[model samples]
Target: MLKIGEVARRTGVSVRALRYYEEQGLLTPDRTPSGQRRYPEETVEVVLLFQRFYAAGLSSRAIAALLPCVNKGHPSTPQRHMLRTERDRLAARVEEMADTLHRLDQLITDADRRAGAAA
Candidate 1:
């Protein structure tokens, strides 16, 4: 078992965030007699998964909705649909970023060409 601070350090998540995750039912740690939070080693993975979902632009409510299905190793139809929607959003963002990169590359090339012509 690990204390909350230890878990936070190991997982690189803040103590407040861990507490928030507990409040959201994303994690349930054991409590010591004095009410200190004690988490199992497995909690590290859970925290990491939570971070990944957050990085993927999932809200806590969305993560909460999918948690049960994820735990069961199969997503229900609605859960799958939700996941697909999020995936599509991510794909669109990627395309937008690619376009931005292409524009920046063109700008850089044009500037370099102009500088060469001036020299």
Candidate 2:
């Protein structure tokens, strides 16, 4: 068992964020007699996984559903599907961003050349 602070230190997450995660039903920490929250060692990995998936645009509800599969020490087919779907969506978005960036770069280069020719 680890205290909330310990979990935060080990996981590089804020204690407040951990408490919020608990409130969101993402994590369940045991309360000590003195009211300090205790977490299992596995929680560090769980929280980090949550962070990565969330950054990848996974919703909290989706992550909540997926956590059970991970906690049980089993892979989830549904979560895998979701991840693949998310990957496709992100790839599409990245392609769009790349196109936009390419257009912007071309505009900047053209403007620079025009300015040099004028000079």
Candidate 3:
């Protein structure tokens, strides 16, 4: 067993975030003898999952709706298909960000070159 602080450190997440996750029902840590929070070993994996889904642009309510936060199969085929579509959307967003970054870099370089030539 580990304390919530330890879990947060191991997961590279903040204690407040972990508590929020718990409050959101995505994470359920047990209480210690003194009412402190204690997490099981598998909690590390769960926290990583939460981090990934969050980074993938999922809101708490959206993640709670999709992930279920429990160890069970999904409800129906539609849910599965929806998850797949969301993943595809995330992939597209990644590509879009890369293109945007490239364009921004090109603009910066062009401006720098123009400034140097005018000087």
Candidate 4:
């Protein structure tokens, strides 16, 4: 077992964030007799997964809801639906970001061409 601080250090997450994960039902650390939090060694990977989920725009509640599916290696019907929905949303966001990047590239090319002509 690792202490909460050790988990945070290994995962590069804050102690406060780990506590928040517990509050959100995302992590369940064991408590010592003195009430200090002790986590399993696997918690580092779990915290990294939580960071990825957060980057993917999942709320804490969403992550909490999906944890069981993740642990079971299979999602229920509603969980499957939710996964699909989030995936579609992420796909659209990626497309939009790509389009924006293309537009910015075009603008930069145009500016470069204009600068070359002026010189």
Q: How does each model score on TM-score?
A: 0.88, 0.71, 0.75, 0.94
Best by TM-score: 4
1-119: candidate 3 lDDT, tens digit per residue: 99998998899999999999989978777887799999999888888988998888888887777765235665467667768878899999999999999999999999999999999
Clashing pairs in 2: none
Q: Report the number of backbone clashes for model 3.
A: 0
Query: What are the lDDT scores of the predictions, listed in order?
Result: 0.92, 0.87, 0.85, 0.92
lDDT for each residue of candidate 1 in 27-76, tens digit (9 for 90 to 100): 88899899999999988988899898899889999999888776786998
Worst 10 residues of 4 by lDDT: 64-73
Report clashes for each candidate as comma-separated counts. 0, 0, 0, 0
Q: Which residue pairs collide, candidate 3?
A: none
Decoy 2 TM-score against native: 0.71
> Candidate 2, residues 2-99: lDDT per residue as tens digits?
99999999989999989989988999999889988999998999999988878878788877877777777565788778666878988998899999
With a 3 Å backbone cut-off (N, CA, C), the pairs that clash in candidate 4 are none
Clashes of 4: 0
lDDT digits (tens) for residues 3-44 of candidate 4: 988998898999999999999999998989999888888888
After superposition, the stretches of candidate 3 with alpha carbons farther than 4 Å from their true spots are 68-76, 115-119
- Consecutive 10-residue window with the lowest summed lDDT within model 1: 64-73
